[model samples]
Target chain A: MIEVRNVSYEYIKNSPVLDDISMTFERGKTYAIFGPSGCGKTTLLSLLGALDAPTSGAVLFDGKDIAQIGDENHRKDNVAFIFQNYNLIEYMTAAENVSLTEKIDPLPYLLQVGLTEDEAKRPVLKLSGGQQQRVAIARALASDAPVILADEPTGNLDEDTAAEITKLLCDVAHENNKCVIIVSHSAAVAEAVDQVVRLSHGKLQEEV
Target chain B: MSIFKRAWTYVSRTRKKTASLCAMMCVMLLLSLVGIMLHGVCMDASQNLKEVLGGYVRLTYSASNDREESVLDEALAAQIAALDGVADYSGISTYYLSAPDVQLVAGSFAGQPQGQVPRFVGCDKSALHENFIYNSFEVIEGRHITSADEHCAVVSDVFANLNGFTVGDRFEACLDSVITQDEAMPEEVYSLEIVGIYTIHEGWEITPMTPERDIAENFIFTDMQTADAVLLAEHGVEKPFYRQGVIFTLNDAERLPEIARSMQNMDGIDWENFELVVNDKAYRDSAASLQMLEKLSLLLVIITFSLSGILLALVLTLWIRERRHEIGILMSLGISKVSIWKQFLLETAIIALVAMVVAMTLSVPCSRMLSEKAFDVAETMAQSQAEEVHDPMADVMEKLNPTADAAVDVVQKDDVHLTFAACITIVLCTAGIITISVTLSAVPMFRMKPKEILSDVN
Candidate 1:
């Protein structure tokens, strides 16, 4: 489980992007942070991903402060990020990108993500937007990290492709017993998740 | 994936950027290598010119001067000869005398009957005389006069032929008769043995009125000690009273001033009556051009290094900026900034190694051709100016003190070789340039956080 305890962040001195926000995400469940464009959903996800520090309070993984675990170690061993636009290493093949963590054989994960053997061996940039998202999903799944953070992972994909990518994230959460946190502004994306936390003005407005 | 594999993949996949970087490095390294080689060649040529020209320093003691006479003794002569870079030295004194029984060679167009006097040139070593140094006279038979020889002379082949004289023959010469016309001074005629015969070169006669004493064939070479004895017998003077003083021939004329300064600092030397004359004017035309080339080559090296550094820095800065997206991707994948930096460094090292090899291949022949062209220009420049800057005063000094200020011919040819030291210096410089450029270019990239970098990627 990952916990955010009164975590507050600010880009500038007097303005808060995430103000004293608290949340809990358990393993074997898919959760969506649903908010409008400037609601600080992504900032909360970045704090959980250990990409940046909070202005006040703490983010903890399994009751221990994430800062104590070290940001690089937490990112490397605890969380795998799936960014918008696929975020694939352009020079590498899909299989190479999947095996970047070097912790697992990427073929199985790539096949599970619905890519063919031939598509897995091709450079990621040569694939379509949907196929590229599948590669990003395979890369996140092949990592040994216990948490998966996807920030608008399917924003660039079509409707059907986005649904497919969302389903794959839910499958990774349930089948691999991992915590999956997806930050998105779409109501359709929030509908499929196990829980939805609606954020407004850097605070949790509602939870369902 | 390992950093090495990542770096290799980027270098191989990005063919255009890799080639561009390699080409820029090649241009920089090639010019630097050539500049280093040219600078080394110029320095070597300068040293060789000094050795070939072989300037001399003459220490003269003048009685007419206001300062106390610093008479040169045997001990002082030995000390000056022992100075560094001194190749040889000679104590010379000139005398005019007439050999009554012997027939002296006349000028090409003998004008005055009073030109019957022959010049007896006395020296510690006749082989170091200016006539031999300038190739004006060469001993064809017998041997040259040395300090060990007593009352011995080396006459020209023309005079020997006219007098039917040979080596081991004796002749009677009287300096008192020529100096004072004193028939009452016991007719101090000295019997001098002929030890050598020499052949004079053409163009020795300056004009029809050239005195027999000025004629090359009428010049007799003998020992300084013998001439001092004759002077003591005639005017009652002691030994070591050298009229023309002593000339120290240096191995390298470029060190003449240094040796002169050192000589002046020696103990018991009179500053006013004593004079140290350094004569390298004959070599000035050639040495000047070589020195100028040396300075120019040094400037070339400085410019090459500066421009190469600036160009490499600019190229690398653009290269790193173009890869900011890649850097963000790698950083988000849990790779440390240090690892990313290592990848970039590896890429640069690969390209720079290839470029250095190519530069080394091209530099050898290119530097050789460039140095040869520079030398040819220097030679032509020296020759053209040598025709205009004839120093008659130096020539007169040479005749008066034969070993001092002897004209030396400029070396016409020199070959450039790449030295190990120069190669090492160039390699170090290239590595330094690459390292600094990479560090400077990477500064902006390293300063950004992974979040900032990823957000900027579009």
Candidate 2:
């Protein structure tokens, strides 16, 4: 479980992006964080993924603060990140990019995510938007980390492909018994997850 | 994937960038290698040149009479040779002679009637003079007459051909009537056997005899003791003595004048009739050139090294800039900044390794070829200078001074080796420069956090 307690963040000293935000992500469940633009959705994900520290807060993985355990170690062993850009290395093949996340054979996971063997062999830059997003989802599934923090996982994919990718993350959490937390602006992504939380004015509220 | 594998994959994928970087490193390393090799060789050559050419001085009798000449004898020659800073010494007693004017007084007193006013000349050899050491004479047959060879003689190749005299042929030196009239002409001839034939190197303005063909052809080298014996017979003296110059050379030229002054202060050296002559011009000329070349090599190393470092840093900065996205992605992979920087170093270092091998392999043969070319140029220069040389210097002074001959060996020798120490230094310096340049270029990239690296992107 990842716990964000009394979290507040700011880029500039005078202006806060996240204010006293607190949340908990449990194992064996998928959660969707919905927010409009500039609502600190990416900033929340960044802090959860250990990309950056919140200005004042405690983000704990298994009741221990992630910062105290070392951000690099926490990110490496606990949290795996998926970006909206499908941030796969353009110079590498899809499978090679998957290999960066896990020591296991990357071809299986890439194939599992609907990339054909030939497509997996081609440079990720040659892949289509939906296929690249699938590769990003497949990479998070392939990693040994228990927590998957994705920022706009299906932000660039069509509804059908986005639903398929959201189902993959849900399956990754339900079957694999991992915590999958996603921040997105799409209603389909929010509806597909087991839990939905809306971000407004640097605070999270349960969406009925 | 492992760090090395990732590094290699990137290197293989970026073929154009790697090839261009390798080419630049190859050129930079090659220049450094050549500069290092030249630095070592120049130092060795300078020392050897100085040893062969420096600290040479000639002492000769400038006598006006028989009494003055007698005082500059064999005993004084030995005393001068024993002085401090005198490394080695050789002496020669000259005798006037000519063929076809065959009644030439082989060995007779001064002011005595000359047998046909002899035009040929002979110099007795005690030790190897600078002239012979510097290839003024090239031995053609048999062996040269040393101090130990009493009755042996070495004539010019032209003289040997003219007389059809091969090695082991005997010749007679006939005494004159002025000495014969006083003593009933006992043992009037001295026997000499031809032991060697030699030719002179080109560019020689000096010879043991004047311009007369007969004299030039008849010039001979004999043992100093043999020449002394003949003079003893002419004067009807019981003991042999020297009537020629003793030239002394030291190991270095720093004390050339000091030794000369010391010899003058020595007892019974006949300083009034004899004076010391310094012959350090050749050594000075060679040292000046070496110093100039050393300065040039220093400048070349500085410019090449600095320029190489700057160029390497520039290209590496571009590579780092190009890989910013990769750096960001790798950081997101939870790789430490240090490990990521290592990957970049590994890539550039791979290029450096290949280029180093190519440069080192070429440096060896190129250094030797450069040395051979330098020697060839020197020989060509000597040849042109030879054309400017003439026989006008063939006079009494030339015969007394062996250095008057053209010393082709002093300028023609070109020997160099690519030493192991210098090669090792080149390798180390090349590696150090590359590593430093890579590290310097990576600093800005390494400073960025993963957040910052990926922040500007969507």
User: What lDDT is reached at residue B80 by model 2?
Assistant: 77
Candidate 2 lDDT over B1-458, as tens digits, reads 87887888888887898999999999988887777766666666567666666557777656553553355556666777887778877676665432332332233322335423333223445235544555556678888777677777877776677567789987766565533454465645667788888775632332333233224334577777667776776665555545556667787765776877787788765556766777765555455555566566667777888888788788888878777878887877787777777888888889888998899888878767765565455445544544344345465444433331232245335455567887677677767766776677777766765777788654
- Give the interface RMSD of candidate 1: 1.4
lDDT tens readout by residue for model 1, A1-60: 899999999998878988898888899999998878877887888789888789999999
Q: Model 2 - which docking category?
A: medium
TM-score of each: 0.74, 0.85
For model 1, the superposed segments whose C-alpha errors exceed 4 Å read A11-15, A103-105, A155-167, A185-192, A205-208, B59-76, B82-87, B91-246, B251-255, B261-276, B282-287, B392-414
| Candidate 1 chain B: worst-modelled 10 consecutive residues by lDDT | B401-410
lDDT, candidate 2, at B396: 41
Candidate 1 local distance difference test against the native: 0.79
Q: Tens digit of lDDT per residue, candidate 1, span B1-458?
A: 88888889888988988998999899888888888888887787677667655677888875556323456666778887887888998887888766667787665424433455688888989987766654467899999999898989999998999999999999988765556577777656778899999997533326665667777778899988778877777777665566777878888787788988888888766667778887766456667877888888899999988999898888888888888887777777777777877888889989988898898889889988898788778777775676565555554334343221222133335566667887788778777776777777777876776677778877
In candidate 1, how many Å is residue B359 off? Answer: 2.0
| Clash pairs (backbone) in predicted model 2 | B97-B120
